[model samples]
Target: MTAWGVVRTAFGDHDVPSTLMGVTVLGYDGQLVEIEATAAVLDS
Candidate 1:
């Protein structure tokens, strides 16, 4: 899936967990595993 596609899926499925200032997912994996967001950073 494209980057935006992942973003959309994450947001739609509430995978983000909380309101995030930003999100960045990397690595080439067949299955979805890790999701990193800037929500905590933004809370600073």
Candidate 2:
């Protein structure tokens, strides 16, 4: 799944991109894992 959001901070609100994924054999134990990742873009 994919999503979009925003982050609130003292500087300002920033755009955040996120994603949810399922993975197989992600670790040495070979277990099923669900991962969520998010990143914010800050103004320079």
Candidate 3:
């Protein structure tokens, strides 16, 4: 499964249905991944 973390409130695009937020993802070899998450699964 893809790991996710460091969720925080951020600017959201009006086109999206749910609230938008920022998140950090961890990768192997000290690499980091970032993505925009919707309020639908912020805690799931």
Worst lDDT 10-window in candidate 1: 14-23
- Worst window of 10 by summed lDDT in candidate 2: 1-10
Arranged by TM-score, best first: 1, 2, 3
Candidate 2 lDDT by residue in tens digits, 1-44:
22222223432553334344555445667566555666566698
Rate residue 32 of model 2 by lDDT.
Answer: 62
lDDT of 3 by residue, 1-44 (tens): 22222222243333434444454655556776556654554664
lDDT value, residue 42 of candidate 1: 47
TM-scores for all candidates: the values are: 0.31, 0.26, 0.20
| Tens-digit per-residue lDDT, 1-44, candidate 1 | 96667788767955554443443754665557656646544453
Per the 3 Å backbone cut-off, how many clashing residue pairs does candidate 1 have?
Answer: 0
lDDT, candidate 1, residue 29? 57
Better of 1 and 3 by lDDT: 1
lDDT, candidate 2, equals: 0.46
TM-score leader = 1
Name the lDDT of candidate 1.
0.59
Candidate 2 TM-score to native: 0.26
Best by lDDT: 1
